[model samples]
Target: MEIVNSAKEIQEYLQNTRRELHENPEISNKESKTSEIILRELEKFGNFNIRKNVNGNGIIAELIGAKEGKTIALRADMDALQIEEETGVSFESKNKGVMHACGHDNHMTMVLGAAYLLSKRKDELSGKVRFIFQPAEELSPNGGAKGMIKEGALDGVDAIFSMHVWPDLPLGKVGIKEGPLMAASDHFTVTIKGKPSHAAKPNEGIDALVTGAQYVTAVQTIVSRN
Candidate 1:
């Protein structure tokens, strides 16, 4: 595949989008404002069929070419983390206790940049391009990707491509892997039920704090031994 070499232009666009997203960070499924911004930008391209309210703030845009060919999908997640922003940038997040530290802002911009480039060359492409703006990617238990799939996001898709911004990679370099590029992430919470008693009386009640500590240690050993 040939690389797009408009680094200066793409960087400028990416910086603007990143700053705007950072200043107005939204969390998880509640990304209405972010979705609106994305929809507005995609609309400006003038040849896409937009679908909104897709699996809770998810957006899909389809760009069909003239010739008959396969359909490819590009995905970008648009949710921010729950951490407080410490970056002293001028466009820092206006929302309290939320930030885009994980580079979803860049993800959206990169895909949009690709879309902009592809839009100019629509006549040359033989197939369709679907841009998926997904939400709740940072949410646990259920993410927007699963929700969109449930809503038929992949019904007619032939191949899908997604990318994440890696800070460890060099500025001009790109990394690609064939299979299983990352590990599966899982979060667990263990709650202990115990009787509460006065602190002055020792051994009167089951200490949940101690039990929780023991359980954490046991979980660590389980993973280590496995």
Candidate 2:
């Protein structure tokens, strides 16, 4: 009850933080500035045992309860995609060719908001809470989570939780489920070799572009047709 009201009180703070992060987006494994801003903001809380530069540019802020209980972890990614921003928003990305296209800026801000609210009620909590600001989440197959875990980010932690923004939901609404809400992502690379020849030559060279397009069409039907 009181915590909910506290959250409302910090609405403007969270918005400002989100906008600041959005304007200076950084790509995966290259979030030094992003981490610095988050670290500075976390410092204002004054009650967290903060760990900096965890597994590169990640930050772990842990808050312990006054009593004995389980430990829960909250995670947020700190990476942006290599996409140009055209939102024309007041706080559009200043980093050309890079943007928070996947809403990681919001994710980070949401976790920070949770940290603020929970820190205020630390005495009432029964267990420990770890707010993990992870980097390189956009780099699938070799994400920053692996490095952070290797560096013991999850050590002594009982469970972890995270969320992503869905535009389908209306404002002030959140969607949840009983099981896994998102699917796994994997990547692969395909190389096509073709010979190049003069434009006037008749069928002397193979066309890699056409071959690649045909391969893409064939791959698309693996789920729909098969």
Model 1: residues >4 Å from true position, as ranges?
A: 1-3, 187-206, 224-226
Q: Candidate 2, after superposition: displacement of residue 161 in Å?
A: 1.0
lDDT of 2 at 63: 96
Pairs clashing in candidate 1? none
**Per-residue CA lDDT of candidate 2, range 2-49, in tens?**
778888999999999999999989999899999999998999987899
Native-vs-model 1 lDDT? 0.86
Pick by lDDT: which candidate is best?
2
| Model 2: how far residue 203 lies from native, Å | 9.9
Write candidate 1's Cα lDDT for 56-146 as tens digits. Answer: 8999988888788999999999999999998798998999998988888889887888788788778888889999999999887677889
- Alpha carbon deviation, residue 211, candidate 2 (Å): 3.7
Q: After superposition, how far is residue 198 of candidate 2 from its true place, in Å?
A: 12
Error of 1 at 14 (Å): 2.5
